[model samples]
Target: MRSILIALPLLIAAPAWAQGDDSELWLTATGEVAVADKTSIELESINRFSDDSGGLYEIELAAGVKRSLGDGWYIGGGYVRVVNYSRGTVTRTEDRLRVQGGFSTDAGPFKLSGRLRLERRAASTGDEIGYRLRPNIKAALPLGKSDFRLFAAHESFLPLDDTDWGENAGHDRMRNSIGVSWKASKAISVEGGYLHQYRLPRNGRTSATDHALTFTLGVSL
Candidate 1:
């Protein structure tokens, strides 16, 4: 586990070592309130920055409920509101509905988890609807008897249905990240690390690569 944790950063950064890409930042804050031993209500907000990393160009607000189905399986459903700012103007707003299920297991000293999510997206301007699927996997290793954990994840977005105003059917985006999580207390934890995102072109546009710093704060109650 220790050796794997030490190698994760190098593995995550190797792909973009020679390529110059846009630098961005993302911060997400989340709070969870327990409804039962296996259920919780989740709330989160994500702020995204652009190349110069000056101000937020996008924001995502999300709320959801999740339940453990016994063993290492779980299910969840959620809603999201996305706001985008660009070119000195408010560009777009999106409403999203999502459903997800996943499973996790302990593998030696590491915990491995995988999830599949389906999303329906509606835009305010065009009103066109789009569907997408996101699949991701993560591995976590706890530093012995400590409050620190090392984790790495890779997530991919695949369009399911085409819409005039949204992503077309194909690969949409890929995000890979490696991070460390610190438990500040029983109810709070903080995570921050490097994330690499690759976006496929839409229509005739060029592909984009984003090298970003990802930060998150999680609170449990």
Candidate 2:
């Protein structure tokens, strides 16, 4: 019962050094797939970052990618893999990788689109967390599409490395959410939200600003 850092799975460590301009004008990418008719189907990610002043910021590796597609639907492009056991260890890739294009319209029953993501992370406990970011929002009925919708985010994290494990931790980590989105189509969907955060130990729950949940089951063309 230690879980924090916005809902955990044990990921921390990786981010040799990163300060600014990694490219792609300042990267951003997002990808997902979720299908839950019987469970065991999920994939999700966010990349591109830079937010400072010791609330923490900086992720300087580059390209990240993941995969998993079955009854749940999955895809991979970047943000490789990571786990922060309150500051244990996990790492795969880094530098720059973010994606976003245009148009996915509909607002009556709900369906909207916007994209940009990229991440090269790993830094859960020691430095708090490193962020490679691409900020963009408006997800109403996603992951197979609509079981529930409504979401919002304002992000910035460019923390490549800094570890004393104190001074505002890793700096700048903010998230506000409203939940319930479970789709089993277009690829997949399953989400849980309503988490106001700033954390550092998940899977058991400690505290740093509590009650947060995130789920990912993904796939996209």
lDDT per residue (tens digit) for residues 1-221 in model 2: 21242222212111211221121112222343334432232233432222222211222332334343343233435434432111222232223344322234577756554444544444433534444444444556432432444454433333444434432323344444455554557655545444344444433544343223344444454
Candidate 1 similarity to native, TM-score: 0.88
For each candidate, the alpha-carbon lDDT, in order, equals 0.86, 0.37
- Lowest lDDT sum, 10 consecutive residues, model 1, at 1-10
Deviation from native of the Cα of residue 127 in model 2, angstroms? 12
In order of appearance, the predictions have TM-scores of: 0.88, 0.25
Off by over 4 Å in 2: 1-28, 31-56, 59-62, 66-68, 73-148, 151-176, 179-195, 198-207, 210-221
* Candidate with the greatest TM-score versus the true structure: 1
How would you encode candidate 1's per-residue C-alpha lDDT over 1-221 as one tens digit per residue? 64465456656765674463677779999999999889999999999987644467899999999999998999999999999887446788999999999999999999899999999999877757999999999998998998778898999999987787857898988998898888889999988778888898887868888887788999999
The candidate maximizing lDDT is 1
